[model samples]
Each structure stands twice: as structure tokens, then as C-alpha cells.
Target: MATPTITLVTAVPNPATFGQSVTLTATVIPLGAGTPTGTVTFTITGGPILTGTLSGGTTSVVASGLSAGVHPVVATYSGDNNFLSSTGSTVIAVVHASTTTSVVSTPDPSTLGAPVTFTATVTPVAPGAGAPTGTMTFVIGGSGGGLFTQPVTAGVATLTLSTLGIGTHPVVAIYSGDASFLPSSGTDTHTVIPAS
Candidate 1:
């Protein structure tokens, strides 16, 4: 019996920024053994799952809408009675200067089922020394999703929407960028009223 080694199979981009998905993937290689027989379980010690799977000593998952912070991961494998657990975790930091972040949404109701102008206005932050800048994506209805990677000028980023379905449609604006520069930070929710 030898130490079971597990490697991260998931690619970590940045977990600190808002709307940034956290995916953890890893491959397990059982040393000094024949045909690894056991169940490999993946668990986010303190985060959410975005997308992933566990099978034949492989695990993966994605975490979404998670606040900025250091998140730990744990992978455990059971062997007979004595559980062989591996403690290999990563850190997830949410970028933000202050504890409270200001976010405003401006959803246009004129162009329902069509492209409309979507705006996300993030008010002056507490630590206003540096403002969050980068890509702010807009997803409307259930199918129409758009991208706006313009810098945040005057605390505003206008996202363009192509089309939205009828009825009350919910819209979300997520700010993504270099999380290391600024931890998990983003704006509030925006809504769109379908055409009558």
C-alpha cells in the first residue's frame, strides 16, 4: 500500500471575480496497486458547483455566483474499511475593495423579442481608489446571452441584448476580469418586461 496521489484535472482561471465559474477537475493515480477499486467523491469544501463529474477515479465541477473568498476542496477515496483521503485544495478569492458593492441595472423594455440596450451601472465603490474594469456579460430571457467587454467608465457598462422572449424575463449582468487585480466583485440584478 502506497500514498494515493491526486492531480487537479480542472483548469482554474479566477474564482474571485463575480459570475466567474469555478471548475475543479482532478485525476487520481493509485500507486502500488492493481486496478483501483473504490468510489472517488468530489466535494467543494466551501463553494458551489458549476459543472463536473466523478467516475473511475476522476472528478470535476463548476461553481457559480459564489462570493469572493478562499474555497477549499477535498477528494476522498474509500478502501475497504480505512478511508484513503487526499487533502488537496485550492483557494477562491472574490475581488472587491469593500465588503459592500454597489450595482445598478438598466434593462430596456422597448425591444422585447428583439435586440435591446442593456446597461449595468455600478456606483462609486467604497474604496473608490480603483474601479473594477473588464468584461461585463449580459444574459437575457433563457436563450439570448450577450457579451460586453468594455472598460467601466464613470461606473457604467452598457450591455447589448439581441432578443428576449415574451413574459417577465429576468436579466443578469456579471462583471468579469482579472480577479487577482480585484477580487470577486460585481453588480446587482437587472430585469426586462416582455412586450405586451
Candidate 2:
């Protein structure tokens, strides 16, 4: 009779971001013996406990929706008939994700040479996540039409154009990323028709 020992291997990406999904993999190894099979339970501190069936001695699970902080994760292998149970652990740090950028152009269809205001709003992922401060590049009618920059104040930036070509213009607003927040952009269309 041979005494079987099991070794557990766990892998997870560290320094993750909030609302980011990551795959956690665990492998079970049997020392000087045959293959190991069964289920592996992955427990994440301040998160959820997930279980996955072992396929060819390997199992993986996707973990998401974690809060912003350091989370300790452990993988425990359920022993099969030929092997003993083992456990492995690791730590993951989740930071705040990038904020969202939403832009709106007033008077979508307006007469040429009229005033059009483009308002860009940057919203953080969660409340108290902090406001994003940077330059907002406003481009109208692609790259060649018009380009300008505005300072983001209190998660809001605005740009107004008094003159635009008489046609469909594609407006793009890009928010320059800052520390603690990633860059984001938004697009909208403004139609300028001929005056009566």
C-alpha cells in the first residue's frame, strides 16, 4: 500500500481593479502516484467561495465584483480516493477602476453658424471614489474639422462651438486620465443644416 500526498497550486493576478473579472486557477498534483481528481474550492477573503470540478487535475473559476482593497484567497483541493487534500493561498489587491465619460451635445440638429454646446461629464466608478481632473480634448467633425481643450472641473467639462460646417459632424470628447482614474472617451453626432 502506498500513502498518497497531494500538492495544490494556485494562481491569481495581483493588483487588480474594482469591477474587474479575473480567473483563478488551481492545480492538484499527486506525489509519486496516479492522477488526482475531484473538486477544488476557492475562497476569497471579503468575497465569495467558489467551487469547480477538476478536469485533468486542473480547475479554474472567475471572480469578479470585488471591493476596493486587499483580498486574501485560498484554494483547497477535495481529496479523492487516491490522494490527500491540500491547500494553497495568495493575496490580491483591488484598486478603484477608471471613471466613466459621458458627453452630450445640445441641439443635435442645428442650423449652420449656430451655437452648439458639448458637455462632457466624468463619473467615478463609485461614490467617494474621487473626482477626475485633467484636460478634455474636444474634436468635431473628425480630426480635421475642429479641436480644442477644456479643463475638467468637478467631474464636468464643457466646450461650445459657434461655427460648424453645414453637414453631419462627428464629435468626440476624450478625457485625459489621471492618477487613480483611467482615461475615457465619448462620441456623439451633430448635424448642421443650412439656414432658411
Candidate 3:
């Protein structure tokens, strides 16, 4: 007859940020005697399925790219010849990372009909790593100016314009955050003078 066995599972960094790596461990214990040997399969809800080989009744796997929410995890131990199979479960929570946006314009005070380039940069707050991806919206001169959208590449977005009447214009750069980062915006002002 096969010996009865029990499995237990745990997650390191229980509350993790989206796209952050997490370690999952599983331990299998035999009811009677002797250590349980074999492999353990981990099934993560909304994540990937991983297999780990047991060493001294314990095994671990590293996973990442989980969305911002609670995810269920299951560990199934493939019992050895003398032990019976067992399963264990756990949960992990992932939160969105905060971000900041800054905007700058080349030649802030420029002459009318002169080319002006506006650049926006997006960066993660503290305790977060990796570049943020998404779209950036450029709002020129409040509501009467114009609105333009550009894709964020390497955490930076830029726009250029040359048709400004002759006055001070307020410029805003809004970042449309992705699955891992939160949205943010930055503002600046540009003064346009009459051509010589």
C-alpha cells in the first residue's frame, strides 16, 4: 500500500508589483516515513504553468508578468512509488506601479511659424523597475489649441508644431499608462513672438 502524503505551498513577496518576479515553493511531506521524491507542477491562474523537480521534499519556481490582481496558485506533487499524490494551493496579489511624467519644449520662447519640438518622459516611482509603455497625449493651449496623440517609445514621446499665432501657449503632456504602470501628466508653457 502507498503511504499517505500532504503538500504545502507558499509564495515569496506575497504582494508583488505587476511584471515583478515572484518565487513559489512547494513542500511535500509523507505521513509515515521517508521523504517524498519526484516533480511538482504549479498551476497559476492568469499566469503560466511551471514544473519543478523536488529536492529533499521541497521545490521552487520563479514566475513574472502577472496582471494587477489576486491570482490563485496550485501545486500538485507527483508522489513517488511509496507515497501518494497530494495537492496544495495559495494566492498572490499584484498591484500597479506608480509613475511620473515630465514635459519639455525646445526653444520655449520662439518666433511665429518657427518649428518647436515638445518632448515627454515617463518614469516609474520608487520601488519599481522597467520601462513604461503606452500612449502620450499632447494638449496645446488648453481647449482651443489642439490635441495630439503619440506612442511612447522607450518611455519618451515627442511632438513638433510650427503654426502658433503670437502669444503664450500652455502645453500639457498626458501619459496613458499600461498594464504595469499608472497614468500621469506634465505641463509647460511656450511663448511665441512675432517674426522679424
What would the TM-scores of all predictions be? 0.39, 0.54, 0.83
For model 3, how does the per-residue alpha-carbon lDDT over 87-172 read when each residue is reduced to its tens digit? Answer: 99999998888889999988878888889899999988865657888999999993236899999988899999887778889999
The whole-model C-alpha lDDT of candidate 3 against the native structure comes to 0.90
lDDT (10s digit) by residue, model 2, range 59-79: 899887777788888999888
TM-score of 1: 0.39
Instruction: Give candidate 1's error at residue 163 in angstroms.
Output: 38
Task: Give per-model CA RMSD.
Answer: 14.7, 8.1, 2.7
Error of 3 at 69 (Å): 3.1
CA lDDT, candidate 3, residue 75: 97
Residues forming the 10-long window of minimal summed lDDT in candidate 2: 2-11
Winner on TM-score between 1 and 2 is 2
The regions of model 2 sitting more than 4 angstroms off are 1-6, 100-120, 123-196
- 65-182, model 1: which lDDT tens digit per residue? 5554666666554443322445344556555433222344444444465556656655433422344555555544454544445565544567555555544545556555433234
lDDT of every predicted structure (CA atoms): 0.50, 0.79, 0.90
- Among the numbered candidates, top lDDT falls to 3
